[model samples]
Target: MQPQSLQLSGIRKGFGADDVLKEIDLSVRPGEFLSLVGMSGCGKSTLLRIMAGLETPDSGTVSIGSRDVTNVDPSDRDLAMVFQSYALYPHMSVRQNIATPLRMRNLSLGARLPLIGRMTAKASVLSKIDAAVNEAADVLQIGHLLDRKPAQLSGGQRQRVALARALVRSPAAFLMDEPLSNLDAKLRAHMREELSGLHRRLGATFIYVTHDQIEAMTMSDRIALMSSGRIEQLGTPDELYQQPATVTVARFIGTPSINLLPVEIDASGRVMALGRPLGVSVPARYAGPAMLGIRAEDLRPAAGGFAVKVLRSETYGADRYVTGHLADDQAVCIVMRQAAGDPIAVNGEGLSHLVFPEQRAHLFGADGNRIETTVPARIAI
Candidate 1:
C-alpha cells in the first residue's frame, strides 16, 4: 500500500494558559486534497504549521511517509507551503523565486553562489534544477512570467509564483494556509478552480487550511472541521452538509445556516416543538429537552402548516431567503436566525405557524448524538 502523505497523532498546542489545538489525529492519503477549515483562532493555521514542521506541538507526533518528523526542521520535511501572503521575493524574477527551493535543497554553498556557483556545481545538479524549475513553471502556467519580478506581477501572477516555488520541490505533500485569502472574491473563486485542476494533474497530496466552508466544500476530497482547537467533524462536503454530527458543524457550514428550534420529547419518544408534534421516533428513555434542525430549503410556503411570520427577506439572484418568526413561542428559536423585527405572514395569506415536515426533522439527544429512531417511523423528528 502507498504510504500516507502526512499524519498527525494526538496533536495539541497551547499558548501559555490558552490551548490552541486539542488532540488532532488525522491522515492525508498520498495524492488526495484535504482541507482544514475552522473559525479564527481555532488552530487551523497552527495545525498546518505543525504539519509543515514550522511549529512544534506541545504534544503529539507528525510523520511523512514512514519517518517520524516530530522534531524535524522546516527545511528537512520534504514539504512545500504556500503562504496566504504569497511570500515572494520582491527583487527576484519569477524563475529565480521558483528555483529557490530547488537550489536550497540540492545545491551546496559554493554551487548556489550566482555565476560562480553555476559554473562550479556538478553538471548533473544544474540540469536537475533547470528541469525541475521549468517543469514547475509549465505546470503552474507561469512559464510566461519567468522573467517578471514580484513587483511587476499581479496578485494572481504572484500567487502562481509562490505555488511554483512550492511545486518545484516535488515535495511529498503540499500545505497551503489560506493561499487565496489575498485575492479578490472573483479571483479567489477562479483560483480555486485552477488549483483543484492543478492538484488533479500532479496527483500530489494537498493539505489546505481555510475558514471558508465554500472553499472547503468545493475543493476538498474530505474536510476536517475545527472549532475551538478541536475537530468538530471530519467528512466529505455532502456528508457534513446532510449528516453533521453536531449543531455547531451544521451552523458553521451553510451560508444561510440551518435553523434550529428548541423542542421537547415526551416520555413515549414523541417530540414536540412550540406545542406541535415533530413526529420523531426516539427511544423511550431519551426524551425531554431537544433541538430540531432543518435547512431553509427544507421549508416550503404551503398550506396546513405552522405560520412563519416573514420578518425579512433577502434576494440572491437565483433564490430568496425569507426570514420570519414562528409566532410568539420563544422555545421555537432559530439557532442561526437572520430574521429581524416583526413577523410577516407574507404570501401565507392567514397562516400563523411554520409547519415543519415531520419526515425531515433531525433530533439531537441531550448528549448531542442524533437519535437513531423516534416514536414515529414515518417522521425523523
Candidate 2:
C-alpha cells in the first residue's frame, strides 16, 4: 500500500475536571517519522490514542490521507498500531499470530470456523495469506521463529513479531506507542537503529510516541514536544534544541538538561548574569527580568569569564563534566570533550573561569517566551 500522511486538527481531550489534551494541531508528511514526546502526564499517549481511533476527541478531526477518519472505527481507519506490550497470544504460534489480521479481513464467518473453515476456506486466499506472512517475516528476519509461541521468544524477537504483524497489513500508517520500552537498555538501543532502518526500507509514515528524549532525537525526522495538554514546540531536533520557543521547551529537549540562570536587563539594555555583564544586548524597548539558557557544551573555560568554585567533577571516558556554583550561589556546569588526560580537579577552593558565549545563549522573558537578543562585536567579559 502507498504511504499516506496523517493530520490532526484542533484536537482536544479531557477527563473530568482536568484537560489532558488542549487544541492539539499537527500534521505528518508522507513517509515521515514523527515522534510525539513528553513526560508521563503530558498527553502524548492520549493524543496517539486519539489518532488511532481508540479514543474519540471532544473536538477536532483526524484524517488519514484525504479521508477524515474522526468518526470511523479503528478497524476502518486502515492504520496499524503496535502497542507497548507485545500483546501476543501465548497459545498461538508466531505464524498464526501474524496471519490473524489477514484471516479476519479476508475470510467469511463460516470459512473462519476451526476445522470446517480450514476445509471450506478458498485455496487462493490461504495461499495469499501465507505469501504475505512469509514476506513480512522475511522483512523482520523472524522466519525462524514462526513456529514458536510467545513464551519461547525473547523480548526483542517478540517485538519483531509484533512489527511483522503490523507490516503484513500494509496499512496507510503505523502508530507505535513505546514499542521498545519493554526491552533492556542495550536491546532498546539496538531496536532504535533497527526501527529507523525499517522505516527507511519500508518508506512508511510512522507516528511514534515515547517519553524518552534520546529515542525521539535519534530516530524522528521531527519531534512534537508536548506539555500540559498542548504541543509546546514542533520542529526538527536541532531546531527545537538550538532555538527553543520557550524556557519550558529548552529545559526538556536536551540531556543533562539545559542550565537556566536568572538574568536581567540593565538600564542601558545590557544583559547581566551573576552580577557580571553577559555582553549581549536586548532591544532597548525591552527590559526587566529574563532567563539565560546555556547548554552544558556551550559553557567553556575562558581566561576572563566569571569565576566559579568547583563543587564536583565526573569523568565519562574522554569527556569530563565540572559542576560548580558562582559567587552568588548560582549553579553552573561545564562539559569538556576529548579530555582523557586533562581533568578538572574539584576542590572547595578551586575556581574556574567559565564563559557563556553571547551567541550561544538562549534568552527567555519572564512569561517564558523566547526573546531575541544581539551579540555585540566585543564583549565585556
Candidate 3:
C-alpha cells in the first residue's frame, strides 16, 4: 500500500474557556512513525482525535495526501485508529471482531443479519473478508486466538486483536492512542518491540499518542513533544536529548530530568553558577539571570570544581545514581550517574567536587528559552 502524508494547520480547540489546543500545526511524512507525547491534559490526544476525524477542529484544515479531509467522516477518511481500550465485543468471537470493519463497509444492513445475511451476501465478498481477517491475524501473530472470544483472551491478546482489527483495513495511516497502556510493564516492553517491528514491516504512516517518554523515544521516528496545548519541540529523540529547544523540552525528554541550576550571565557573556565561573559564555544579549541544564551522565567528579554535598546514592545493577545538593545552596539538588563500583571522592564533610565540559551543558535564558553558548576560546584552546 502506498503511504500517505497527514497534515494539520491552524488547529485550535477548547472546552468552555480552557483552550485545549492553540494554533497547532503539524505535518507527518509518508510512512513515518510520529509520536505525540506529553503529560496529562497536554492535548496530545485531542490533536490525534482531530487527525482521525473523531474530533473536529474549531478552525483548521486536516489533509491526507494533499486532499483535504477536514470535513470528512471518520469511516470515509480511510484512517485506522487503535485505541487504548481493546473495544472488542465480548459476545463476538475474535474472527467476528476482526471482520467487523470489513463487514460494515462491504455488507448491506439486510446482508449483515446472522442467518439470512450470510446467504444474501456475495460468496466471493465473504471469502475475501475472511482472507483479510486471517491475513491480519497472521501479521499480528494472533492466528491461534481466532476461535476465542474477548473474555477468554489475556490483556496482551486483546490488544493484539485490536491491532489486528486495525491492520485488516490497510488504511492510509494508523493512529494509535496509548494502545499499550493497559498491559503490565513486562508486556508493555515486549509490545513496544513488536510495534516497532510491525511498523518496519508495514511501512505505513502512523500517528501515535502517549505520555510515556520511553515509548515515544523507543518507537517513534520523530517525536512531537506537546505541553500545555502546544508542541514544545518536534525532532528526533537524540536531538531533543542532546540539544533541547526549550526548558520544558529539556525537562521532559530525559529519563532523570535534566538538572537545572540557577545561574547568571554577566556583560561579558560569562556563565556563573553559585558565584563561580562555569567556563561557558552565551551571546551578550543574554547577559542576565539564566538557568544551566546538565544531564546526570554529563557530570564527572574532579578534585577542583564546584562542590556538592552528598545526600544519597542508589545502585541499579551496572550503574549508580548519586543525589546531592549544591554546597552553597542546599535548595538546588543534582543527580549524577556513574558506574556502580566507581568510587566517589567525598571529603569528611560529605562534599564532592563535580565538573562538566562547557559544551556538555545547556544554558537557558530567564524566559525559559535555550541560549546557545560556546566554551570560551581560551578554555577551548
Best by lDDT: 3
**When superposed on Cα atoms, how far off is each prediction in RMSD?**
3.7, 2.1, 1.1
Residue-level error in angstroms, candidate 2, position 371:
1.2
lDDT of 2 by residue, 1-381 (tens): 899999999999999999999999999999999999989999999999999999999999999999999999998988888999988878889999999889989999888888999899999999999999999999999999999999999999999999999989899999999999999999999999999999999999999999999999999999999999989999999999999999988999887688787888877888888787877888856588988888887777777776777766777887767777765565544443325465454335588777766898999988998989887766533
Backbone clashes, each candidate: 16, 0, 0
Better of 2 and 3 by TM-score: 3
In order, the Cα lDDT scores of the candidates are 0.81, 0.88, 0.92
Off by over 4 Å in 2: 330-338, 342-348, 378-381
lDDT of 3 by residue, 239-286 (tens): 988999999999998877788999989998888888878887777889
Question: Best-fitting candidate, measured by TM-score?
Answer: 3
- Runs in model 1 deviating more than 4 A are 1-3, 329-353, 366-369, 378-381
Cα RMSD for predicted model 3? 1.1
How well does each candidate superpose onto the true structure, as a TM-score? 0.91, 0.94, 0.98
Per-residue lDDT, model 1, residue 102, is: 81
Model 3 — which ten-residue stretch has the worst lDDT? 274-283
